[model samples]
Target chain A: MSKDAFRARLEGTAAAIESLLDRLLSSSPMPGEIARPPRVLDAMRYAMLGGGKRLRPHLVVETARLFGREDEGVLRAAAAVECVHGYSLVHDDLPAMDDDELRRGKPTVHRAFDVATAILAGDGLLTLAFDMLADTPTDPDPAVRIALVLALSRASGLGGMVGGQMLDLEAEGRFAADGKPIAGSEEDTLRLQAMKTGAILAASVDMGAIIGRAEDSQRNALAAYGRALGQAFQVADDLLDAEGEADLVGKATGKDAARGKATLVSLYGVDGARSRLRRLVDEARDSLTAFGPAGDALARTAVFVAERQS
Target chain B: MSKDAFRARLEGTAAAIESLLDRLLSSSPMPGEIARPPRVLDAMRYAMLGGGKRLRPHLVVETARLFGREDEGVLRAAAAVECVHGYSLVHDDLPAMDDDELRRGKPTVHRAFDVATAILAGDGLLTLAFDMLADTPTDPDPAVRIALVLALSRASGLGGMVGGQMLDLEAEGRFAADGKPIAGSEEDTLRLQAMKTGAILAASVDMGAIIGRAEDSQRNALAAYGRALGQAFQVADDLLDAEGEADLVGKATGKDAARGKATLVSLYGVDGARSRLRRLVDEARDSLTAFGPAGDALARTAVFVAERQS
Candidate 1:
């Protein structure tokens, strides 16, 4: 498929996933008119329904198709991934964390509501994601479901997203364990980027494959594809941070360099980072051979990762 | 059993459970740790290992016993509960949240680490709980595992703990959902309180029962028992806030009154609060008849919850 057609496919997938999540979110209870605070509902709605690329969930639904398993089960998994993604952004923008004031061109959750409400709202969304997965129709063997839950949790937890945040925090003049600098070496930086951004993406694709009954080797191959794609995503993100317009990016730009946040450009310089990203794109494409022509969406995703400005 | 012996039994259960968690935690990789940062490790350790009373995990293990199921799988369920509880405490102490400087008479996670580290650590622990549940070896039954994950996630999430927090936050300001004064009714106060404290405690007990293959009705009974006990637990907590010696409480005492935090004592004076607590305790004990003597640990838990000083 040509790049334009591929982009169109991704956009379509994003819409489908967003609609599913919107439905899932609208179904949550409002405490009561006499007691239900609109702020809580507002915060929850803003965090979950605030539309983005829906990259994670798209990866899920598309990858599920590879194994001929596209069902309602993918919807639950999609919501679960999106919930985690939304929460990470909310928490990341908190005053104590990244403390950004804007998200997706709108005020961040803490800025929209108060700090406590945002915190609780994010917590609510995160937990609800797991609840969605846990409640998935048990047609998939219990063993498979357990593995799915495990992958989703780990992807969101210390080994993936949280672990990435810890490294980011510790790198910013905070000491690290064993007195090693939190950020050092090109390999270390890439590894951190992969775990933080890549792991969840990998989980998204790999999980869809697993749910669709893909063989173990196929799942592992997709995981490799996701990790490569995730690296490219971060590098593209870093590039946007460097040169993209804030309006197009939909949030603050140039903040990464300003905050001295340890990113690809910081460690490897612009040219070096781009060079590495090109390599990652190729690696990602190579990993897609397992899916054969069925990975057209993902193959286009890799190219988009390397070239997208935002 | 004497109170000390009873406390010891609970403590012992927690310790064994913790021991299981230690193994599980160590076995899981720290994702961002290429060489493993010490500060991050310390932060994770601080919030997780050797911290707080392992009440949630103990309840899980004990509840499993109530259902006549005791196996390695319970250990995984217990670990999941502890991880959630730890995550809550870590976030609860953040400067933006409760601003608690001490937990369990030790420096809180944020105090020990920085605010950002504490936040990520809490996030890590919370997600890790779900991951832990995914690894249960005994019951490969996805439905059982899924039930456990769903129950735990809901308890920790909005319809449960997080929701209760928003209510508590509003209550603290004496503002209802519409920015009006909260009703000064005992029913209103208990309703919110039950969702907050009661929800997760109920989940804790129900988790054990469900894992032990308890029928839905038995699970409901355990949930009711836990809800009552959990409320009693909150009542005792409020009582501590009001009447317990500051020195004895060791953690912060009277913070509820000082912060204008909403609580049973805040709404009802000491006598009224005590009377309400007595009713909850009686209900908790009465629910135990269903378990016959099998509910002995839970029944004893209710009595201690009603009478304990701290």
Candidate 2:
């Protein structure tokens, strides 16, 4: 697959995800709900609907497609992944967390709304993700739906994304008596990054496999591909923060270094990080080799992750 | 059943839930997880264990018991409910939300830990609730597991408890330009209370019904009982807040009136609120009438809600 073809597919998937999210976050109450609480609903919409690379959802959709499963259920699962991703971002940008004011070129949810609303919105989104997965529309098989929920909760819960965020905060010396940032070892950085960013990214692909009912070997292969792709994506993000212009990156740049945040880029020089990115991309592509032509889009995606400017 | 019997049963259930939560939130990581950061795990433990009436979990266990579910799975489901309840309290006590310095005669999570740790702990707990529900141990049947997940997410998400919290904030005029607390109408207060407190309480019974595989009519009766029980619980809580001593209640009292918070107690005066509580308790007991002797404990619980001094 050519770069242009991959970009078009990515963009198309993002658009579809945006539409689905809009419908999901509508002001009307869902069944079993009393009222939508418009302010929180609006904040949730602001946090989720308008923008994102939609890379996670795209991975979900494309990986499912790779396994010869194409259906609306796939899109629903994809949207569910985006909800978890979006909720994490919203909470992460709070004053108590990263304190990021801008995300994807728009004000962070806490900045756009009050802290209380932002917190509630994040909670709502996180809960809704599981709700969506358990719904029959996501998959006809109850076992499959339960599997998706279990995978997502494990990926996003204590020892995964949330734990990763906690580790990141600790590395920033938020809990230290001295209140000074402390850099971690290279191995520690790897573990932290994997937990914080890589887990959810890997789960996105893993979910696709579950939805598509992939064989154990196929699932393992996709999981390997996803892990490498996730690391590559993070390295590329760090590289963008280190080198890309703020305008192009769509958020503040060099803040990672300013915060003395532990990153692979900080341990490895820009040149070394770039080389690692290349290798991870190669590994990601290699994992999908067993799938042959069906894996082309994913292989292209690995490249796109490594080569993304923002 | 005598009051002593009910109290002993409640304490036994609470102890069981505490043990389950301790095991679930252990420092060791679960499968697929990379690592459990000690600080966050500690925070999660601090937020969850050694607390409260465990009223929600007791409701779950007893309701299931009412339908003859006596296995360990009932306790696991009950523990999951407590996780959600714990997560909500942790978040609600944040400086940005209720700014509660204490709970159950001890420091709140945010007071004991920093705001960031508290937030992450809450997130971790919330995510784990679904993980627990979807686990095979919760139910041998995937459909039952999915049903529990769907019911929980709806009860706790946008239109339910989280939405209720948002409405409560709005009623306090948190979003108003003038920054003045505004009292809501009686109807608005009812809606808000139902969503915020009643929904989860109702869900506890609904989950019991789901786990016990209750007949549709039995489920409906239990749901009605749960809803009324939930309202009675909140009204009793408000009365405690309005009139109980801080020492006996195990936390500060009269803060709601101080903050000009809307409550049925605030809308109807103490005498009126007491009358309302009695009527709700009656309604709750009435809903459980079809269950005959199995409903006796639940009926007593309603009276307990209305009459408890603390």
Candidate 3:
């Protein structure tokens, strides 16, 4: 496809993903006026709805299309994963956690609301994802749903994103750890990045695949796509942190080094990080070969990750 | 049976709950360091292992026995419920939330560890409970397991514990408002208490019924037991806060009114609250009549909840 064609597809896909997000956010059944609550819900809605590429949902849709089914059932599950992703970001930026006061060109959830509400809102969103998935019993066998639940839980819990966080907490200000150096080889850099960002991204794909009834081989390929794409996505985030415009990025930029945070560029330098990002995108696209022609969204998303400006 | 026989069952059941709590704490499939993150894990173990009544887990086992099956499966479900209950307390005591620096005669989790770790530790336990229930699929069908997942999520999320919290937050100075005596009725007070401490207590029984194959009538009865038990439980807690010894209660005592916190006594006079407590207990025990002889543990538990000291 031409650049224009791909761009149009991305815009249409982003719109579709936004509508799904709207369903997820608007569906909360909790009645309001919580403690005169300082507009916590407003903060939560602002952080989540104001900005997101929805790449994860897009991947879910593309992978489901490989199975030749694009029903609401599949889309809802896709949306649930995206909600989790949104929740993580909101909480990650909390004063007690990452402490950023800006998100998506708006006040961060914690700043807009209180820290307590931001924390609860993040928690509400996380539990809501599991609830949404568990509510739909499309998988007839008790075993399949069990597997899907386990997959998502493992991805979200201590061994995945949360675990990565513990690692981040421990590794901050360290010279070189987890086989990755402050200036290390590509693989070493990836090992560090994988635990930090790669695990959830990979789990996001496998979760959607298992629920959408992807075959074992397809699931494996999806996993491969997830790892490659996740690293590229992280590298792009690092690049944005290094050189992106504040207004365009919609978040406070240039804090990666200021906070002494670990990133590919921090480990491997900016040029090396850029080179590795291209390599990751190439491999991520190659992993889509198993999807034949049905992997267009996954492939296009990888390219977008490598080239994203902010 | 005499009091001796009843005491034996209570001790044995409490021991069983303790064993399950320890096993879950140390034996998850996650790597040791990842599963048990030092002080955070210690705080979780301490808060859960403290010598309390083991009220919720006992309800699960007794209710499961009510249905004539109390095997590994039911105990596992029971254990899972305790995990959720224990974890909620850990997070609820965090500085960002309730800010309790002490609990159950020991330091609170956030005070024991840091606030961030306490928050994540609680999250780990919450998801771990559902993961356990969802993984063991021998009894509850996918549909039923699906229901259990939804039920637990709702109980833990804003609609239940968190919703009650919002009320607790709103009710915080509600009594002293404008110095105009006290406002709201006994009905409103009961509803508030039911949501706060009562919802999950009730959920413990409702969950047992859901997982143990109880009939609709039995389930309804158990739910009533839970609601009434939860109310009585809250009332007992309130009484302790008013009149119990600090050492006896294992935490600060008589701090509720001094703190201007929400309690039945805060809404109604002390005499009125006492009378209401009696009525709630009667109603709670009355709900168990449908269970025939299967509800002995539940009946005894309701009485204990109404009158227990610390």
- Best model per TM-score: 2
Least accurate stretch of 10 residues (summed lDDT) in model 1 chain A? A29-38
Q: All models, DockQ values? A: 0.50, 0.92, 0.39
Clashing pairs in 3: A105-A250, B105-B250
Model 1, B1-310: lDDT tens per residue? 4677778878887778767767755634744222333455568777777744677777888889877777788878887888888888787777766788987778899888788788777787788788777665735677788878878877777666677767776766633555544544677677677666777788888888888888788877876788788988988889998888866777878777776556788777789889988998888878778778777777778887788766
Clashing residue pairs in all predictions, respectively, total: 5, 0, 2
TM-score of each: 0.92, 0.99, 0.89
DockQ of prediction 1: 0.50
User: How accurately is candidate 3 docked according to DockQ?
Assistant: 0.39
**Per-residue lDDT over A1-310 for candidate 2, one digit per residue giving the tens place of the 0 to 100 score:** 8888888999999999999999988888889999998999999999988767899999999999987887889999999999999999999999999999988898888888889999999999999999999999999999999999988999998889999999999899888889888879998888899999999999999999999999999999999999999999889988998898987888899988998888878999899999999999999999999999989999999988888788
TM-score of candidate 3 to 2 decimals = 0.89
Give the lDDT of residue A213 in candidate 3: 81
The reply for model 2, stretches above 4 Å from the true place, is none
Per-residue lDDT tens digits of candidate 2, residues B206-285? Answer: 99999999999999999999999999999999999999999899888998898888888889999999999989999999
Best to worst by TM-score, what's the order?
Answer: 2, 1, 3
